[model samples]
Target: MSEGASFRTYFEVEGEDRSRLGAQVGEQRRRVAARLAEIRNVVAVMSGKGGVGKSYLTAALALGLARRLTRGVGVVDADLKSPTVARLLGAAGPLALSPEGVRPALGNENIRVISTDFLLADGRPLRWREPEHERFVWRGALEAGVLREFLADVAWGPLELLVIDLPPGADGVADVAELAPSLKGAVSVTLPTDESYQSVRRAMASAQDAGIRLLGVIENMSGYRCPSCGSTEPLFPGSAGSRLAEDFGVPLLAQVPFSAGAVEVPSGLLDRFLETLA
Candidate 1:
């Protein structure tokens, strides 16, 4: 394997012998290590179910960390099919390959982002050019390979933190935990409801099963924010996030609304999470 060979290219190039494939695999692992070596912490934000604002919270966390830490922060949107972190963080367009590796786009607060969103055309869903019938057999494996490239190939600089927005499912959480051994922990995002947390619990359990620590629970859309009075009131019944945290023996780190006007950003939430990283 050449020094320039990357995980992304390993997927692109084909027809290599077994010995060469082994060296390429080793080289790709080295690339992943070199990329992660500069990153201080890796945290995966996940929800077992979708529509929980996981990506929004991921972008918020990435931007917030960049502001507070005064160091680089990067986000990897591992949600290949429906990636939105690029738009959420304002990382737009045409990513070119630098001599170092694939260059990540710049988002707000100078946050670096690598996502499949940029790879797709506008309004185009991720599609494999392979035969439809053959896809069922290899799709999962192919997606997993893409996830590897996202983790290993991008030229992410020295970052104080790297937040990964895992796709909505217990498997996505487990996949990331298995892929990145440097993972510090995982923060489960759930809505304030029994059903929501119940679904989210499977993801938390998956992370734990993969040997990743559970940082805490983030209760998104916990309440409605009164934009006029700047007050927060209950939108859902019961202390759902608290209950979820209790079940997992972890802290309920935050109860955020959907927007500030949508979900209130509580003061010191970022600060508290930072303490956990320390």
Candidate 2:
């Protein structure tokens, strides 16, 4: 077989077949090295629980950093099971694949996105049997050298920052700690509620155990401004984000208020976030 064909066949296998494992490992390393050369910073956006607006924050940060960062920005939807970045960006559909890769990332403005949602047929559910099932999928992709090719060979041009939108809870955090060691730090997102704050604290500790730096915390759904009375109401109450940041020696970067408009991704807010980074 030709070199190109041989490389293609390496990843086109099923299950944990350890036959060509050595070759796969070497290829993965090379891919990781190439990806590291181009992408300067990798930051994971994580939350301890669901309904805390983690995905929205990831989109905001990516769009924000993309506008400010010199090289460019990309968002990797590491939340494989519930990938929604593509839909939020209005790029949900069949994606074109090339010899360059399997599925191409959809681009908007300066941001490029990759997600499992792009792989599935319309409305297909990613129902993994066990909790380890998703992790196994991720591991298989990484081991088969698909992830390296996805990250390194993809046409992500000149990225200064790569934002990873992780799955909710500690599983995603554990995966990042194990596989993607090049991540600069993690940006934890949480609501103003005490329960949400406590969950975020646990996540922080998990990341710390993995030796990942806590870049900062972002409080979402924080306060709503009453247009009539000109007063701010605490939507969820308690300033737990501030307390956690102080306790962990990390910055409480921003407290984003809930907007009453249609729940489309806020390009204006993203622009403002970029400006702040600038």
- Tens digit per residue, CA lDDT, model 2, 5-91: 644464576566668678776676666666656777777889888888888788767656655666777877777767887666545
Shift of residue 228 alpha carbon in model 1, Å = 1.2
Q: In TM-score terms, which candidate is top?
A: 1
Best candidate, lDDT-wise?
A: 1
Give the per-residue lDDT digits (tens) of candidate 1, residues 1-278: 78987565655767766568778877866777778989999999988889988988888788777787876899999999999988888888688798987888998888899888998988999999888886778999899889889878888888899999988999787777667778899888999888887888887887788878889888888788777886888888766689888988987888886454322235567877887777
- Candidate 2 residues lying further than 4 Å off, grouped into runs, are 1-23, 127-153, 227-231, 262-278
In Å, residue 87's CA in model 1 sits off its true spot by 0.8
Error of 1 at 123 (Å): 1.3
Deviation in angstroms for 263 in model 2? Answer: 7.6
